[model samples]
Target: MTTGRAAQARRAADALRQRIVAGEFANGRLPDEQALGRSLDTSRNVVREALNLLRDENLVTRRRGIGTLVTAHTYRHGLDRLAGLAEELTPYGTVSNEVREARVVPHAPPAITRRLDIPERSEAVYIERLRWLDGGPLSLDSTWLAPDIGHPLLHRDLAGRDLFALIEEVTGAALGSAEVTVHAVTAEPDTARVLDVAYGAALFAIDRLTRLPDGRPVDVESLRVRADRFALRAVLPRS
Candidate 1:
């Protein structure tokens, strides 16, 4: 059941959310409800409802006489480069990993094995980690590595290090490139629980396969990212 007011509020909230994330409000404060309503071509009640929605998302705060305030910080992830999460995010805030699962499996799933170019029933190393930015959960990464490259990482420190850097160290070869795909998905029960999001909350899934300079596949990873905490950016020139 959807009402006109609710729909309008959501629309208003989306617009404001983008502006806040873009740093349009340089002072981190928003105009009064009436002014915002006029700019957004809506009524004061609708604008108030929109601001409340932002408040629920922890993106804004409202006070009696102070009006609405933007309070969320979104990290920009450039899609044009091949870099690790920590490597890209450290400039903004501290990044850490919680290794939830790290073990050598007798055989990985068929699809993963195919992507890694291993035999159908070949063994592989599996790593599942929860990535934290500052003090909050940012993403959940599940990576499957070919044995030759992964065995060396079993004893290495995975908590405070980036897998990309470690992989280069173990192989003595720099990573050449990656095949990456990004898409939106709803959080499943397990993912929602791990990321502390409500069931069916919107999330960004990044699937990537990394190759060495010689073009041999070494890693296949899928990262489930918190949509509100991250944004993907890239510069594309028309050909």
Candidate 2:
């Protein structure tokens, strides 16, 4: 049998989640427990439990005596399919570009070397950009491609272009699959400057390695996005 407090907690949590999705609560605002409890006709204990659920999901945070605040949404992409930056930002009407630093660079990092299967100290094309949404900075992206497959890319106009499409067109390498990982991070000074946010601001960092149909590594992209602007959702297959 379900206890009254547990039921109340579930109801309050669901109600609060709906309110958040509906934009009624507004981001970063802290509503008092008493007010939330009254709104849901429940006790403060139930409200607290509900808020704790949100905090666990990375949707909210509680400070010492500062109440609970809404955190930004983080987007998650499936490992089964490959997507471009533009496609990822479509829902938000976010605009992005290949910054001036998008060029071939030598001596790739160890992580990049391993992902792209390149020799240590090998040259690679480095693409850098600042993504914007409704004219506001959204993310800072840096991608590395093996020189053997990236040299020809330099001849093309990449500004405001999608790197994935460019790779397909140039190499005729159809994207088959990708491995991606997402994590929370604090922005560094350079990343902060490009994203137009303060240093140490919360960020959602994504690291992805894409492969061709034959399983050859094609590109490795590192994406750093503002925690507040992006949200990730997924539908899983039940076995």
Q: What TM-score would each prediction reach against the true structure? A: 0.86, 0.71
* lDDT of each residue in 175-230, candidate 1, tens digit only: 99999999999899999999988888778999999999888999999999988778
In model 2, the runs with Cα more than 4 Å from the true position are 1-80
- Candidate 2, RMSD to the unseen true structure: 5.7
lDDT of 2 by residue, 23-101 (tens): 5765567589999988888899999999987776556889987888876543433334578767766675656574757
Q: Which residue pairs collide in model 2, if any?
A: 74-232, 75-231, 75-232, 76-232
State residue 233's C-alpha deviation in candidate 1, in Å.
1.3
When summed lDDT is taken over every stretch of 10 residues in candidate 1, the lowest stretch is 65-74
Which one wins on TM-score?
1
10 residues in a row with least lDDT, candidate 2: 72-81
Instruction: Supply the global lDDT for candidate 1.
Output: 0.91
